[model samples]
Target: LAKTTQPISMDSYEGQEVNITCSHNNIATNDYITWYQQFPSQGPRFIIQGYKTKVTNEVASLFIPADRKSSTLSLPRVSLSDTAVYYCLVGVGTGANNLFFGTGTRLTVIP
Candidate 1:
């Protein structure tokens, strides 16, 4: 397990797209870079994952450069309900390991 840094907060209007970037300079070889979204009073929902290059799924797209030092999460056409905390995580391969949720980017979707 390792630590990551992200913006404390971001504000945007409803229906606007939101992009959150996270940094993980100390990522290990066996580690996977993953993104999660969390709303108040709820658990995080896995958004995307990338070892390198880019990965896109139904929820979000993850962009990772060759260095793997940083990644971006893109949420398309977000609504007010999308306002939540976005977390970038570096995790081991163990599927059941508890994730250490750190301070993340708080996205505020305004009307």
Candidate 2:
């Protein structure tokens, strides 16, 4: 598994855009990048996943550079409810046992 690193925390105002970046220097060719968001006690929810370039969904967008060494999770127009811990994962297969998670970034959305 490739080791991942992320910011310990971040702050953003409501209605603002928030970006959380993760680094995986030793990423493998088969590895896929994934991001998850966790709110308190609830299980982490999938935000986005990609193997290269950029991918977007209704909630967030993931940007991966050509080198595939890192990825950024972009949250547009964040709200107070968006406050949570965001995790960056890397792996080759699906399912919980296949992915490896980082320490995660704590995002605080202030009204």
Candidate 3:
């Protein structure tokens, strides 16, 4: 498993764009970058993922550089509801149960 590095915390106002970056220098070629959001007392939910280049979904966008050494998660027009702990992971496994967990980036969205 590759280790990911993220900010300890972040702050933002409502209707703002929030970008969280994760670093994984030892990532394998088959590994994919995945981000998850977890609220208090709840399991983390998948946000976005990508192997290389970029991937976007309804909630966020994932940008992966050519080296796959790092990735950034972008959230547009965030609200207080988006406040949560965001985690970044690098792995080739599929399914929620197969994913590994680590300390995540805590995002605080203010009104």
Candidate 4:
């Protein structure tokens, strides 16, 4: 498993764009970069995933460098309801045991 590092916390005002970056220097070839958002007392929800380059969905966008050692999750026009703990996971499969968790970044969206 690739160990990921993310910011401890972040503060953003409503209607602002927020980018949270994660670094995994020891990433593996088969590993896929995935991001999840978790509210207090709730299981993490999938935000985005990418192997390389950029991938955008309705909720967020994921940017993975060619080296695959780092990734960024971009949230456009964040609101107070978007406040949560964001997790970056690097692994081979989507199975529960395959993914490892780290201390997530807490995003506080101010009104």
| Cα TM-score per model | 0.88, 0.94, 0.91, 0.94
Off by over 4 Å in 1: 94-100
Which candidate tops lDDT?
Answer: 2
Q: Write the per-residue lDDT of candidate 2 for residues 3-96, one digit (tens) a residue.
A: 8999999999999999999999989898999999999989999999999999999999999999999999999999999999999999885545
- Candidate 4's clash total is 0
Q: Please identify model 2 stretches exceeding 4 Å from their true place.
A: 94-98
TM-score attained by model 3? 0.91
Per-residue CA lDDT of model 1 for 1-111, tens digit only, reads 467889999999877778888888777787788888899999998888889998989877888888888888888888888899998888776743535456889999889
Off by over 4 Å in 4: 93-98
Task: At residue 101, give the lDDT of candidate 4.
Answer: 66
**C-alpha RMSD values across all candidates:** 2.1, 1.7, 2.4, 1.6
- Among all windows of 10 consecutive residues in model 2, the one with the lowest summed lDDT is 93-102
Q: Let me know the TM-score candidate 4 reaches against the reference structure.
A: 0.94
- lDDT (Cα) of model 4: 0.91
- lDDT by residue (11-48, candidate 4, tens digit) is 99999999999999888888888999999999999888
Candidate 2 lands at a TM-score of: 0.94
